[model samples]
Target: MQTEIIIAGFGGQGILFAGQLLAYAAMDNGLETTWIPSYGPEMRGGTANCTVIIADEEIGSPVVRNPQVAIVMNRPSLDKYEPLVKPGGLLVVNSSIIDRTPERKDIQAALVPANDIAEQLGDRRMANMVMLGAFLANLPVLSIEAIEKALQEHLPERHHKLLPKNYQALREGARYLAEKV
Candidate 1:
């Protein structure tokens, strides 16, 4: 199975790190994975996007022109990448920043109040992880346990102590989606 996911947001929102975590989890799950990030001056306040591909077979390219999932954390990101998502793909929107919905009818969009959820979790910075949880719940390619393990391995040693809180944030986001769907 091949799944291509695009995550976009402003700098310092953990958009790239979220993509990396997904790729690492895919690798830990014995799948081939690649993470391609769009960095540079545009990433300052404009837009930062990363494409992550996970497949049971070999991946042809790390860059994704059309992804199976688009996780957008800001209005600019949603405006830029929403149309690029493949038909029948999932679009995870951070409702805290985005007010509009995708115009496409073929794709399914999930508007998650990531910032609000993270605030409720006592750390607004975990908004990315909250979105990741929603992604896992909708995608179902990897288990929550695998993602938790991947987080533990991928986070820096200094940030290791916050793993449990992040996991809880993920669970809260997943539960929110579960209740909705």
Candidate 2:
């Protein structure tokens, strides 16, 4: 099976990193994957997004016109990618920063207060992990354990001290979404 996902948000919100993490997890799980990122010239505060595709066989293209899943971290991203999600697909939204819920009836949605959850966890930067966890909870394209292993192996040594919180954030995200649904 092939799954295409899009993660979008402000540049500094770890959008690209989230996509990379998914790619890494997929690869480590013996799946084929591709990660492609795009951002405005403004960088940090500008809009940023990435596309991740996971499949059991060779991938033909890196560009995805429509994705099966979308994790939007801001309202602008929600507006842009919401309609682009395939019918019956999953949408994971950062509820703490986004004021409203999704309108589509064809797709399932998980409203996660990622920023608030991460803030409570002692770092707002981990909102990406929260959102990623929420997505995994809904889709399970990659198991949480797989993701944790990928993170432990790939995250830079300098930031290893934050592993506990990050892992907590992932579990919290999954837990939060499970309850919300």
Candidate 3:
């Protein structure tokens, strides 16, 4: 099995972190994976994105022209990547910020109000994890437990105290999506 995913949003939205968590989880599950990140110069307000590929076999390329999954956390990201999703692919949108719907009709779109949910969860920054939860709820590629474990690996030791909040955010997002579906 192979999956190519693109996660995008503003620089401070933890877009790269989400992609890194997914990559780490894939590796933990013994899958071949690649994560490539890109960002603009404006730092917090600039655009940031990452491409992650997870496969059961060796990956041949890091470039993803048409991703199987696209997680869009902002209007610019949605506008840029929504149409690039392959037919029958999944488009996960952070509806807390994006009100517009995708133009494509061939793919499945999951809308999660990630920012709002994160705010409710007591921290707006966890919105990325909320989006990640919503995205993973639909795909059985990795278990939630695996993702939590991967999160530990990606976060620095000093930040370990915040893991519970992040874990809760992930579960909340997944629960939100499950209810929506």
Candidate 1 wrong stretches, greater than 4 Å: 42-44
Instruction: Give candidate 3 regions above 4 Å deviation.
Output: none
Clashes of each: 0, 0, 0
Candidate 3 C-alpha lDDT tens digits along 1-181:
9999999999999999999999999999899999999999987989999999999999999999999999999999999998899999999999999979888999999989999999999999999999888888987678788899998887899999989999999999999988977
TM-score of each: 0.96, 0.97, 0.98
- CA lDDT for candidate 2: 0.94
Error of 1 at 173 (Å): 1.3
User: Residue 109 CA error for candidate 2 (Å)?
Assistant: 1.1
Worst 10 residues of 3 by lDDT: 138-147
Error of 2 at 176 (Å): 0.7
Local distance difference test, candidate 1: 0.90
lDDT of 1 by residue, 98-137 (tens): 8887889999999899999999989999999999999888
**Which lDDT values do the candidates have, in the order given?**
0.90, 0.94, 0.93
Ranking 1 against 3 by lDDT, winner: 3
